[model samples]
Target chain A: MLTAILSGDTPRSRILTVLLLAVLVCLAAAPFLFPGVRALETAATICIFIVLVASYDLLLGYTGIVSFAHTMFFGLGAYGVALASTHLGRSWGALLVGTASGAVAAAVLALLIGLFSLRVRAIFFAMITLAVASAVAVLVSQLFEITGGEDGLTYQIPRALTPAFRFGELFGVNLNGRIINYYLVFAASLVLFLLLLRIVNSPFGRVLQAIRENDFRAEAIGYRVVWYRTAATCLSAAVAALAGSLYAIWLRYVGPDTTLSFEIMLDILLMVVIGGMGTMYGAVLGAVIFVLAQNYLQSLMGVAAGAAEGLPVLPLLLDPNRWLMWLGILFILSVYFFPTGIVGRLRSGR
Target chain B: MSPGGANSPRPRPQGGVRLAARPDAGAAGHDPPTEAALTTTLLATDGLTVRFGGHVAVDAVTCAFRAGELTAIVGPNGAGKTTYFNLISGQIAASAGRVSLMGEDITRLSVAERCRRGLGRAFQLTNLFPDLTVLENVRLVIQARERKGFGLLSTAASHSGITTAAEAVLDRVRLADRAGSKVSELSHGNQRKLEVAMLIALDPRVYMFDEPTAGMSVDEAPVVLDLIAELKHDSDRTILLVEHKMDVIRTLADRIIVLHNGALAADGPPAEVMASDVVQEAYMGKALEDV
Candidate 1:
């Protein structure tokens, strides 16, 4: 069953398998294990980001396509959910409608961008995506009446998925709609991740990898390079948008700062790289580690600073406010040590 | 056979019925009238040309390659041999011209479309998926040929037929043992052989080879040459080879088309083209002097 789920492309390393299992277990039991609102929120974010980063990997790692407009797709999903819920009222049907429309819209936009830019050089495609992404960001911010502008949209979901709806108590913990919602996100993310795994191990995925390796040779061998690339871009965009819908559902809010910010795009890139490029398991690890660090690293640094209060420069260096600097240093060290990202390093037995 | 204009009209036989009448027409120049009557043109270029800015790379060149023949395109450096191949293969768009396959115009087709239309090209430089294993490199070609490359959610391993076919191709090329090894790890000669293996897997009606034996050791060259020779046995497949070595051309090519400075300099059998004064002055002057 595991082989079928993974499409027979296993982690191929003992450590990677263990690490992946640990992530899966932690995510599966995030509510009971973490036992805090903050931890639950972080867990949900990790779940959504895992899907987002993995979709990006389908483009960047597997297809050798670099796209900066991923956050735009994510934002589109969030907006889709937000706008539908805002206008259509708080219902499951509204959420479904929003998610589907968002995905379709993102796919259409991606197809247009891909057809126009993918025929050019890779660098040109990158530049065009960057430009298109920033343009969409600006447009979203400018469309005040419909998009809620910079303030964004804070809309309600179905009452069953809200924190107010409580069924009972389990293990002295309140079994509320919030926990149910977390599981909903978890299930969707898992299914999406597994589907992505199946895709990367499919014949289509092999052709994408062949294109990544050598587009010229792939074309010569009778694969339509442009069509395959455009298809990949569309698929990646739709998945990213789906992740965005889940994010909006979790937060009960959708804003440019939360979903569409360039920072989120950069974070997705970092996660994909830090975990591993081509391996789907890398997305799980990358999202978990990066999200955990983003959430808890500051507190960890504060504790270290407290412990080193007597030390002069050590305390200053370990200050909680300098967490960004510490993250930068950690990124540099990881890149130096785990050049192929953490999953690649583990799988290679390095 | 006449050695002049490649575009000259010939009394083409209607179909398979006339070919059986003259079974001994295999030897070129033996029976010119019978050979012309029996030949079927598989690929033709009509005033095919390409220009790079101010330079006409492949000038107005018209050539027709018949089925059951291996034509070697020889030329001096920068004589547009590779450029002409590129134009036909749809790698480089022709500034103006028409390329036809099996009597159907395919000048505006994409590279993949052209390949799907039975135009298989092997690059002068080793163009391959270096990261993939040798078996995988050929498997992709076979998968593409089978139109199974678009199978999403269907695991590649599920297609046992593709693997079996790929293995058969590797066995033919003698790279069966190296099937699991990456293409990058293969020796240069083995890589070239893998290139031919991929082309064979493509199973195109027209085989376009651009220096298939370039940059190989003495022993490695013949493995590919032998494969090309083996491919020549198929009368249905039309083969066009761009080569620099005179001896290799003399041994393999049934007809020779010489290009000098982006123009057709001579077109004939190997002996006649080799002894032609125009070819000698344009391409083989230095080589003949060395001899």
Candidate 2:
């Protein structure tokens, strides 16, 4: 199973495989072990973000393109599903419609950006995507009537996935809407993750890696660089949309802050870089580590803050109020030491 | 397996000043100068020109590469040999004039489009997918030939036909033993061989080799030159070799073209062009003996 997911037979790979399996088993059994809504919600968000970051890796790691517009697609998916559920109908059919519309819209947008902006050099292309993403985020916020302005939209999900539908008891635990929703998210995320694995292992995936390594050489060998880049962008955007739709459904809300924030984009970049660029396992590792830190770090900072105030001179060194500073310092240290990200360093066994 | 396989008409000299005259190689058991085969043009540039602001890089260079022959373009530094090759290969758009491949106009095609139409090019500088294995590099060339770039459902590793073909190409270049090694790990000469191997896998109709043996050590230069010679005879492909080594030119080139200050200085059979006074003054500097 380890060999199926990862390349090579090194000891590092074996260790990572075992670690990944442990994480998977733990996630699967989380609700039962913890038996609470908060734990279940945390586990579910981790799952959604796993899909999101993995899709982002398709561009950043595999295709060697740095796109800052990932969250735009994510927000598009959430908005699509949320709008469909409210206006069309709060049914499974509406969910399907929402997912399809969101993916298609994101694909078209990606294609257009790839066509027009990709002519620039790499760093410049990144700037163009950043500009376009920022502009769109503002557009989403300004459309107050339809997009609910800055507050965002809230709507019903399919009844089957809601608290109104109790699907009996399982293993002495009541299988209510909450438990069903968690399982649904878990199953969907797993399927998408595996599908992404299949894609990255295919010939098309090899071409993407080749492009990443040297697009000029790829073109010299007769591979149309633009078409391949555009295809990768579209595919990444489509998958991100799927993740966004799932997040909206899981939360029962879609807002500018929740769905389309630049902060979320920054978080994704940190996740991918911290996990490892190019390596699929890095996406998973990065998402799990970063999301967990995000959820608990503030509280940990609060505790440290109280303790630091009592200290003689350690107050400035580890300020409890500046969580971002601490995170940034850790990030710099990781980058300085690992250089290739945590997964890359671990796989290299250095 | 000469080019055209007894079907092509010989190339006719377009209206241009003849720099040197010499005996054609027809009497030496080569193909007789049927007006048809002698005039069969595989690639031709008509008044091709390029300029960077006010500095013209390639100035009105009109020449024809015959279907089965090897032509050497030689000149001193800053002579526009590489730029001319770039224009013909569509690396950069020509400022003016047209480039044609086998009678079809290709002046406006992109590099990849030109490649799809059987134009193979190797850069003066070694360019390769350095992160890919040597076999993987060749495999990508073959994969491009097979139009498998969009084969999302099929695994690139499991494609037996492509792998076998790629291995065969590696064997031809004698890099089969290092097939699994990364391109970056290979020596410079080996990288040159792998670049040639990639072009061979492309199976293009015309090959444009730009300074193929440029940076090789003395011991490795002859091996690459021999491989290139073998390629010319083995495939019967039209070859445009950009070389500065006069000995290499004398050994392999059927015809020689000398470029001076972005203009054609001399064009004819090797021995006759070697004897031209204009070539001596503009390119060879001291004399033919000094080089």
Candidate 3:
């Protein structure tokens, strides 16, 4: 509000301001430090993940509704765009239509899911979302007639910016030229991120948080609790769908595996939980950590596997995939060290 | 007994629970005293009834919450005090009668609809956004009010007007010092006060406060009561307070209404209502039994 913008240092806002600044600066510095544009691209992808985490925070953080099927919304956007553009013989116009349909699909799913679960307790809702996610994964995999099953779908997308990298001259673009996609995704993520930030700070956002903390009390004061939750879900779903669409565009491919994966759901849940539920910037923090860990773990696996095959000494090296053994350890540590996740850290003025 | 740290005060009065309304500095330029004063019928429930599956919680009770005055509904435990509040607030469906607000049929109105029509409420329980600052909670309601009045988003300068309005309400509630404090950080007493502040802060035409003083000490009780009186005496907004403390009711309310067994036991001036035979039997039996 006006007071928030005008006045200095209300406890939560102060923390938020600092965290936001740190996230932006770190992201800006990514390319310079990594010595390649690819590094910056990776950072942008992380920013997209932040969008996902932030949307989940709206549902899980502010509204206190943990949705296991939110990834389905994301996957819907990803695969929906692929099928629409490639099969329907379309272009950027199709991309626009695909985004709208993706959001609509998410809203419809939320409505049907919310109809039964909103009245039920929180844990029950979580269980139902989990059920939907699990079922959707199976359904997408079996529907070869529509989805092309495991083969997935990939189609060329027209890009005005592509020619800039076509010569492999500007910043030495090559087959590994994911840098442009990173910038594009980053720009989209930033726009959505800022909009979501305003929303959480808006009156509507406060009401959603109030509902999160306690619904019975909110209802007594004439807040239509159900409506607020449903609306929040819709907005959050649309954001997730956006991220999914961007993900497909970045990879230039989409498949049943992309839309149906529980891994994506777990990753999103982990991102928000690690970052902080109620805070928007926490999502960004969570995303950075998640993406970094994934890369680091994958690299470690590649090193260990390659080194194990031919090491000068101590040839007792194991496969890098063994790093999976440490994933549980890392998750436990993050949850333990930061009970409130990253949001709690920011709240403490970190 | 008050489950909260808000210790029981006056054994919970019987009948109507009224809350104070927001004060306007006469921006309307229409003098309430010179006018017919809204006919004291902002809300009316006709043969309104509610039943909880097997039991009739509120039975065929016809009552009206009027404009321009504070009317307190006080009753003992299980007297359908909350059931009645729920009926009016549209938290639950009315089994039978019609509820009309501002002469418009509002019986089937959703809670949000009632809010849109300048109706705000304070709960017997704290309904604050605990993580939000005291100022922010009021501001959200202000925004909610503005959205209802001016289609979601007005201009920036007009939005600043809402901030000013929120600031004034905080000052009125004596919570200006704690504007930056989260609801969770506030004491139990302050939370009760904040609940009272929120009820009046939105500048609603009608307010229903259920047991506004359930947790306050006798000293704190008077502060809330005086605020109620101040809000009602403004002559613009109407208030309905449910209180167990007769002293608060006697100090603040223009008229006192008593509900017993989900029916009107007494409705009149404080002294007259206090002397009713049914009210005496249902309410004062223990407090003044020996006398």
Candidate 4:
């Protein structure tokens, strides 16, 4: 059954399988297991980022396309939800309309970009995507009336999905709509992640990998390289948009800093590389490790700094404010040691 | 056997620039065969030309390949032999002309579209997916040929039919044992063998091999040649080979088309073309007495 769910693309290594299971279980029971408001927020962020990073993998790892417009798609979805919920009066139907429109808009934009730019060299494509993405970002910040500009939008979700509506207690934990919302994000993320797994293990996925390895040969082998690439771009954009919708729903707010920030884009890239490029399971590991480090690494650093107080330079270096530096060093070490990312290293049994 | 009759008009260089200024250059061995065989031309180029800046790499060189015959295209370095193959296979667009396959003009078609219309091309350089296993390299071609390349939900592993077909091709190429190994890890000879195996899996009506055995060991060369010979037995498949070795061509090609300075220097039976003075002078760079 597990094999069928994974599309028979097994994790390969025992350690990797265990790690994946642990991540799955932890995310599945994040509210009960972690049991803190901040912990739950971090868990939700990890879930959304997993979907985002995996969608990027579909482009970068599977199709060998480097796209910087992923966060733009993510922002589109958030804006879609924010606008619909505000104008149409915070209903499930409004959320549905927003999510659908966001995904469709993202797909259309991706198609246009792909048709215009995919025929060029890889570096040119990358540059075009970067240019398009930054333009979209500037447009969002300039459009104050509709997109809420830099301030962004704060809107209400359905009453059943908020913390105010309490049902009962279960296993000494409060049974409120907040936990229900967490499960909603978790369920959607799991389904989307599994669908992505199915995609990568399908014949279409194999063709994408073939293109990644050698686009010229893929073209000669009777596969329309441009067509396949465009299709992948559209699909990846739609999925990223969907992840954005879930993120908006979970946070009950949407903003440029939260969704459209270039920092988040770089974070997604780091997660994908840290996890592994081609392996779908890498997204899970990459998002979990990166998010945990982003959220808790500072506290961990503070604890280390306190312990190393007597040491001369060690405490200053281990200071919580230097967490970004520590993160950079971790990234370098991971790249230097694992090379293929954590999942790749584990699967190779090295 | 040569298909067209002596009365059939020959291909003339379109532009004013005469590449090989011999009057009898394109008119070799136009004798009508005694027995009229109803041969269908599978692939044909009409005034196919490509120019780089001012230099015409492939001059207005027109040629037709019919079913069941293996035609070897031989030329010296930079004779536009591979460039012609590229033009026909849709790798390089022609500066002026049309390419037709099975009676349909495919000049404007993309490489994949041409391949879908029964045009298969194997490169001189090994072009297998380096990251994928040997079986996977062949399997992708089979998947693309079977039109399952776009299947999203159906797992590739669920299709036992594709796996079986891919394994069969690998078995034919004698790389079945190395199927589990990555293409990058394979020996150079095995990589070449896998290239042929992928073409076989494609199973196009027209097979274009650009130096199929250019860098193979002696023992490895025979396997690919024998495979090509087997493919030639199929009367519906037309084979075009670009080779430099004289011995390989002598043993395999039914007809030889010699290209010099990107023009048709000689086109006829291998024996006739090999013995021609033009071929002797231009290709060999020496007279019969010089050797």
Candidate 5:
């Protein structure tokens, strides 16, 4: 399997195949090895994050078109699900409507922004995404009424097709409700990941890489350069929307601040970059690193919050604290030593 | 097999500049010029022209390229030889004039589309993707031909026939041993050879080779020249060569064109063009023997 995957096969295709197989094994062994149902549901949520980053990787890492507004699709997805469950609140139809709405909304946003900014190039593209995302955050926060402002909206976790599990009998562990959510997200993320892999291995995928390597040459070869870039952006936003919708459903809480924040965009971008751009596995690696760091920082901040007020070392992260500083340090180190990200360094060169 | 087959039309001089006036091989068409085979004009330009600010680089060139023959455009420095080639291949748009390939107007098409329609080009300045490996470079074009590109995220070069063709072309170019080497590692001569190998591996219906032998030792010229000659008679494609080497052209070009001051100064078989006064004046302001 290792030879089959890494032996000149496309980076993403092989990765997806390996990951899918692993996910299957993990799902099958979930009850036997793990004690809690909540953990399984949380794992599913993590898997969704993995797909979201992978899709973003295609645009940012592969094509080198970084848009900080990428997670806006996720927010769109969340809102779509929120409106559907509350007002449109149809049962079976919410899944399709939510996913499609999220994707379409994200794509529309990408298309509109891309029309103006795709012409800009380099750090300029990043600036546009940042500007747009920041603007969106402000609007969301200021709206107050429909978005519930800072209070956020609460709803029950959308029911999954799979039956909910009981941790009570197996290991005396209580999942509360995260187990079903875990499996639901895991299944969805795996399918999307595989589909992305297929697209990357096809003829269309090569153009993206070719564009990445040299856009001028690719254009000279008669490709519609801007159109392809826009298509990629649209696809990326759509996939991110899926994650956002799940965020709404999984947490049973929809908050404008969480969905529209620059901090969230920074986290997603950091995950992909620290994990590596252009390599599929980089997304998973990035998400893993990001989640772990968040958990660790939260704990560290908890300790410092109890200490001194003015000079708490963990500062914003620990005391009313700043997690951003530690995260920035992590990114700096990743850039310093593993400049190509984990997956990229291993994929290129003879 | 002389590449300019029996059907190639005796080129009709638009401005009455007879083939005999140009210096190098300016004699009349070897065998009364006949129409090139097939109804299709593989590459055609109608009054193609380019102007750079105040200076006119290429002026109103009207010509057509056909399959199964080797044609070269030759001239002295600053004569806009490469510029003319760029205008035809869509690297730069003609200030005025339409370029068409196989009956389709391609003046407005992007470079990649022209490539997809079987138009392949070799650059004068060594435009190989420097960071990619030798074999990987060839595989890129081959995979493009297979229509297996653009969609896949995989870095693997060959999953089928594309790999074999890439390897075979490398071997044909005698760079088979360097397949695993980075492009930067190859000797300059090998790099030039690799460029031709890259152009041919695509099996393009028309191969535009610009100065295939630019900076080679006298000895290295034959390897590339002979390769072009072989490619010419392959019966599968036509060849458009832009060369600076006279000996290489004298030995290989079926027909030669001289561009001087953005205009066609001569066009005829090699020996005839070599003996023309117009060609002489275009090059050094005197007949070939005086220089």
Candidate 6:
């Protein structure tokens, strides 16, 4: 089974198999061990990003397509749920409607884009997506009544997920709304991740890899390259929207800044590359490492600053609040040293 | 002056069964006789022209590549042999003309569309998924045909049919042992062989090979030529070969179409075309020296 993880049955794949199992175990134990609301929230956020980054990997890594409109789809999903909760009455049925709306919108938009714009060369497609995404972001911000404009949308979440709805306690952790929501997010993320894993290992995934390696050759062999790529785009968009829906439900908020911003898109790209581009496990590893670093590095630096406050030797660089500064350093170092991201490097054993 | 003027022998219809024959068949005045008798022109081009800005790469090449025959397109450098192949296979768009496969106008179809309709091609510059293993290279092609190449739920390696078909093609190409090796790890000759393996996996009706033995060693060239020869006799497949080697051409080509400066210079049986003054003057001197 581990041999099926990557294309080759090498020692690296065995290591990867062990590593993946360990990561899964750690993720399963995270909420129980930490118990803090902040830690649980962070873990939930990581779960969301894992889906988002893995979906993006379907495009960039598997299909060798680069589109900047991924976050737009993600935003649409969040907005779908957010608007449903605000206007359709805060019910479980409304949440379902919201998630479905997001998925359908992403699929339709992705189909149109894939059919029309995929005819152009790769770099041009990226540019067109970038332009479209920016326009959508602006439009969402401008539609104040519908989308809440710059203030974004916030509404009462369904009562089932509120703190008052306590079922019981499990393993000393109170089985309340927050815990239920966390478990819900965890379960959904797990199922979606496995679905994506199945997709990447499927015959469809092999064709995608073939196209990624040499699209022209793939076309000559009788595989409709355009249709395959379009299918991939739609699939990735749908999954990204699912991630977005999860995000909206977790926070009970949907805003352009959180869900639709270009920063999130960049962050996804960073995660995919840092994790490993083509390897699905890379997405998992990258999300965990990146989310941890982005979320905790500031606090870790804060602790360091408190300890070394009087030391003049490390003054300006060790600022705890300057998170991006340290992240930039880590990103550059990873790219320089690992080059192929952590998974790629480890697989190659270089 | 006409494209068909090179071959004026109009092959007479043996049974007079012209049910689906086009009404304006002889409208061009100088129709090649070969088409008159054997109406099974599996693939053909009508004044297929391609222009690269100021330069005309392929200038109005009109010819029929019939079924169950091996026709070789030989020429000097820049004679549009590869360019002509590119146009027929839908690699590049024609400047002005039509490409028909099995009497269906396929000029607007993409490369994959053409392949699906049984037109297989092997490139001169070996093109394979470099990162994938040799078995994987063939498996992808096999998988493309069998699974409609969009099976999202099932694992690729789990399909016993796909693996069997891939292994069968690899065995035919004699690369069964190197099935686990990456395409980059294979020698150039083996890579070309792998391309043929993919072509065989497609089981295409009409085969178009563009310099299939381009970079092979002397020892390796004959094996490929022999494979082409074997394919020719084994199946009633229409083969369009573009080769520079005179020896391989002599051994395999049933008929020869010599291209000179984006136009058909000579087209006939190999012996007659080889003995012709036009082919001797333009292409034979350089091509024969190597043989």
Chain A only: list TM-scores of all candidates: 0.99, 0.93, 0.84, 0.99, 0.80, 0.94
Writing each residue's lDDT as its tens digit, candidate 1 over B174-236 gives 899999998999998999898888998999999999999888889878888998999999989
**How does each model score on TM-score?**
0.92, 0.90, 0.82, 0.94, 0.81, 0.92
Candidate 6 CAPRI assessment class:
medium
Instruction: Report iRMS (Å) of candidate 6.
Output: 2.2
Cα lDDT tens digits for candidate 4, B1-291: 111224422344322212232323443323222223325788887667888887777876667788899999987778789999999999999998789998799999999999999999999999989999999999999999899988999899999999999999999989999999989999999999999999999999999999999789999999999999999899898999998878888888988887766656567787776666556664646423232
Q: Write the per-residue lDDT of candidate 3 for residues A1-350, one digit (tens) a residue.
A: 63434222233657666766777777755544464655765776788788888888889888888788888888888877777778665477777777778878887888888876787888898899899888887777788878777778877665633324443433433432355556677788888877776666656776787688768656545577887888888888888888888887777788866655888788888888888778776788788888887767767666666766766643333456556666666778989988888668657755
Model 6 chain A: ten consecutive residues of lowest lDDT: A2-11
Per-prediction DockQ: 0.73, 0.50, 0.18, 0.80, 0.32, 0.59
Worst 10 residues of 4 chain B by lDDT: B14-23
Candidate 1 residue runs with Cα over 4 Å from true position = B1-39, B286-291
Best-first order by DockQ: 4, 1, 6, 2, 5, 3
Candidate 5 lDDT tens digits, A1-350: 64334433444445545654564576545644555545454455557778888888888776778788876777888877776666655365765676677778888998988777786775898888888887776776677777666666665434553335344444544543455556566677767876666555545665676677767656644455677787778778888888887777666677866676667777778888778877777887778678756656656666767675676453445543567677777789988877888666555531
Off by over 4 Å in 4: B1-39, B286-291
What is candidate 5's lDDT per residue for B237-287, written digit by digit as tens? 778888866666777777777666565556666667766655654452433
- The predicted structure with the larger lDDT, 1 or 5, is 1
Q: Tell me how far the alpha carbon of residue A190 in candidate 3 is from the true structure, in angstroms, after superposition.
A: 2.0
Displacement of the residue A278 alpha carbon in candidate 6, Å: 1.0
The sequence of per-residue lDDT tens digits that candidate 3 reaches over residues B1-291 is 111113322222234322111112121211122235337568776666776776666655666666677887776667777888888878789988887788798888877778778777888888788887888777767766666322212222235777788888888777889999988999888889888888877678888888888878776666677777777766656787877776667777778765555544456666666655545665556542332
DockQ leader: 4
A268-324, model 6: which lDDT tens digit per residue?
A: 999999988988778888898899998899989888877888889665567787878
lDDT of 2 at A129: 87
Model 2: reference contacts kept, as a fraction: 0.70
Candidate topping TM-score: 4
Maximum-lDDT candidate: 4
lDDT by residue (tens digit), candidate 6, B40-136: 7788888788888867778777788787889999877787999999999999999888999988999999999998888999988899999999998
Put down candidate 4 lDDT per residue, A205-270, tens digits, no spaces.
999999999999999999999999999999999999999999999988888899998999999999
Query: What are the per-residue Cα lDDT tens digits for candidate 1 across A24-106?
Result: 89989989988889999999999999999999999999999999999999999999999999999999999999999999999
